[model samples]
Target: MSIENDLTEFISRDVVPEGGVTETELLISSGKVDSLGLLQILGFIEQQYGVTLLTSGSPKDFESVQTLASAIRKARGESA
Candidate 1:
């Protein structure tokens, strides 16, 4: 599966309990995702994309599927 697809799946199964996440939704602010969830997401990104996420970066990096995909791309040295 693509990174976005995988991430969407993860968010659906792990983050949101009832509804679901949209690409542009504010995951952190929506009460759908929390700090522990962010750690899981970072781990998922690292394992799935084979890159270490910078701990020094902003929380915005894990804000949504779209933004996370861009962060993964940038981490892989691809143009974001």
Candidate 2:
């Protein structure tokens, strides 16, 4: 699957709680994810894509699908 799809599925299945909604929406702005969820998502990305995610500044930097995908591509040494 594409990286976006993988990210969407991960957010839908793992991050969103019951009766919650997940999309390419502003996850941080919407408060859909907390600090713990951010960490979990980072770990999930690392485990799934076989890449390490290093945090710089705030964890919110990795909050959105686009940001996470870019990070993954960077970790894989692929063009983003």
Candidate 3:
């Protein structure tokens, strides 16, 4: 599957429980995703796309589907 499809599925399964995942949604602050969810997402990206997420201090990196897709593309040596 494409990145967008993979991301959509990930969000649906891991982030959005009741409603559908909006691309503009605030994943963390909206309480749709927590720290553990972020970690699980990181792991999923690593295992599925050969991406390694190494965050220094920015929790905002994992805050949205767009951001996560960008990070995953970067980690895979691809341009977002």
Off by over 4 Å in 1: 54-56
Segments of candidate 3 deviating more than 4 angstroms: 55-57
Poorest lDDT segment (10 consecutive residues) of candidate 3: 52-61
> Relative to the unseen true structure, what is the C-alpha lDDT of residue 68 in candidate 2, on a scale of 0 to 100?
74
TM-score of model 2 (CA atoms): 0.77
lDDT of 3 by residue, 1-80 (tens): 77767877887877566675766677888888777776777788778877777653256667777777877777667997
- Alpha-carbon TM-score of each model against the true structure: 0.83, 0.77, 0.77
lDDT of 2 at 54: 58
RMSD after Cα superposition, model 3:
2.2
> In candidate 2, residue 35 scores what lDDT?
78
Indicate the worst ten consecutive residues by lDDT in candidate 2.
Answer: 54-63
lDDT by residue (tens digit), candidate 1, 1-80: 77788888888788675787777788887788888887787788778778677663566776788888888888788998
For each candidate, the alpha-carbon lDDT, in order, equals 0.79, 0.73, 0.73
Which residue ranges in model 2 land beyond 4 Å of their true spot? 18-23, 55-61
Taking the tens digit of each residue's C-alpha lDDT, what string does model 2 give over 7-65? 87888788886544444577777788887887788788778888767543245546678
